[model samples]
Target: MAYDEGLAQRLREALGDLPDVVEKRMFGGLACMWRGNMLVGVMGDDLIARVGPDGMADALKQPGARVFDFTGRPMKGWVVVAGEAVGEDADLADWIDRARDYVEPMPPK
Candidate 1:
């Protein structure tokens, strides 16, 4: 399935207040980048986040959250969450925030 453009738009709107936020096509969807670092993305009907290895185990505990497996193997520090999970709950912001936090600390070129 293709990524939902509407959902991507909503996500873009949500991140509108952030400066230097960029959206790029990736993984059959759209990836949100902050200061040249990838934070999260829209994949099909799911939201994929880069939570870093330290938070991977805890992030997997959330309902509707699962390891991201685009190819054959599941990635350790990435997660795929249902769109409804994010759309219905404000707590989803925590996940997005975690991803943004992780990426924001990286040195920009």
Candidate 2:
């Protein structure tokens, strides 16, 4: 499955000056990593985020949030934000920031 370059680019732009940010192809989409940890990604038309267990649960309560079941097992700390949820700049940035906060402070080398 070909990933969406347009979405990938948008994610990169949102990352700004974050250090050690890298993009990798996975799960038929683009996984945006910070210090070797996956913070946010674009899977098909979905914007997936690793927002930790607590935040993950809360995020799922939102209208377009769903568990990210990439490996057949439903990952507890991950959620997929539907494309509609990220239609605006502020919404997209908020989700990315939340994911980044969860993954930051860890060694990513």
Candidate 3:
């Protein structure tokens, strides 16, 4: 499955300049990690975010956001934000931050 290159570029810009960040190819898409944990990613035309199990409710309330279930199992705390909802930089950054808030405390992988 090919990821969305356009969305990946925006994610790169949003995550650029951040410390301890790494870009890796994952799940046939682009994954950006902060401190070794996945902060955000691009799968197809969707944005994947790891906002922690506690953050899912609020994150899902955002426009074009939905629980990420790529494997047929709904993953807790993860979300898939539609590309159209994140065309604006602010929205993209917000998703990044939501993921960061959860992964920042995890021990790096």
Candidate 4:
């Protein structure tokens, strides 16, 4: 599936001035990596976030967020934010920040 270009642009603008950030293609989408750790991306108009294990439950409680089950089994520590969840720039930035905070401490790959 083709990823959302507008969403990707929004993410790029939101991540402006963030050091060590890079854009790459993955999971049929465009991903933003911070310090070589996967932070966030957009898949077919839905926002994908690596919220970490501890934040999974709460992250899903947010509107338009659900398990990011690319395959049959759902992956832990990640969620897909869709619809109204990413409709606002502030909300999208918050989601991206959450992923960035979780991945920033991990050793780069």
Per-residue alpha-carbon lDDT of model 4 for 5-87, expressed as tens digits?
A: 99999999999888889999999999999888889998998999999999999998998999999998898999999946898
Ten-residue stretch with the least lDDT total in model 3: 8-17
Candidate 3 clashes between residue pairs 3 or more apart in a chain or in different chains: none
Q: Count of backbone clashes for each model? A: 0, 1, 0, 0
lDDT string for model 1 (1-109, tens) is 5898877877787788988888889998999988888888999988999998888888889978999999989887899988888875365577778798678788764
lDDT of 2 by residue, 45-86 (tens): 889999998787678887689998878999888999888888
Q: Which stretches in model 3 have alpha-carbon errors above 4 Å?
A: none
Say which prediction, candidate 1 or candidate 2, comes out ahead on lDDT.
2
Q: How accurate is candidate 3 locally (lDDT)?
A: 0.90
The segments of candidate 1 whose C-alpha lies over 4 angstroms from its true place after superposition are none
Give the higher-lDDT candidate: 2 or 3: 3
Position 31, candidate 2: lDDT? 91
> 71 in model 4: Cα distance from truth in Å?
0.8
Candidate 2, which segments miss by more than 4 Å at Cα? none
lDDT per model, in order? 0.84, 0.85, 0.90, 0.90
* Residue 69 shift from truth in candidate 1, angstroms: 0.8
Per-model TM-score versus the true fold: 0.91, 0.91, 0.94, 0.95
